[model samples]
Target: MAKETKNFVLRLDAQTMEAIEKWAEDEFRSVNGQILYILCEALKKSKRLPKTKNEPTKSNT
Candidate 1:
């Protein structure tokens, strides 16, 4: 099966971009992939990702 992909444009400072590039190289992934992987992991860790259709409602005081 073929893998799906998407494109996006992200802005960062030169130093931060450089660091991400280096990390991507170390992990044998493209910079974009590394960034996505990191964000997915972070969201999973924080339990704020993969949102459901119905979010909880706030009580009206």
Candidate 2:
């Protein structure tokens, strides 16, 4: 099954948008994908991203 996503409006200044656009292009990702990647990374860094059953937990060697 595919994950469901919600849509909403976000407001950003021109400079910020431009920067994101450039970063997205450099990484070969659409702006939306880039934004999602960034958000997921932030969540993971803060240990706030919920883990799905299928996701494997990191094991210390």
Candidate 3:
């Protein structure tokens, strides 16, 4: 399956950039990958992402 992605420019302060770089390195992912991971997690936490077939469903007992 092909996933579509959009490219955009982001500006960060020097300290913020340094922090993100360190975090990315620790996670063994590129800065962009780390950013994307964080964004997806936030979306999931906020229930903003639509349900997908591959995602497991939770049952209420």
**TM-scores, each model vs. reference:** 0.67, 0.85, 0.83
The lDDT values for all models are: 0.86, 0.93, 0.91
- Model 2: worst 10 consecutive residues (lDDT sum): 52-61
Which pairs clash in model 1? Answer: none
lDDT tens digits by residue: candidate 2, 1-61:
9989999999999999999999999999999999999999999999899987777878722
Report how far residue 34 has shifted in candidate 2, in Å: 0.4
How many steric overlaps does candidate 2 have?
Answer: 0
The best candidate by TM-score is 2
Instruction: Report the lDDT tens digits of candidate 3 across residue range 1-61.
Output: 8999899999999998899899999999999999899899999999998988777778622
Rank ordering of all candidates by TM-score, starting from the highest: 2, 3, 1
Each candidate's clash count: 0, 0, 0
Task: Compute the lDDT for candidate 2.
Answer: 0.93
* Segments of candidate 2 deviating more than 4 angstroms: 55-61
Model 2: what TM-score? 0.85
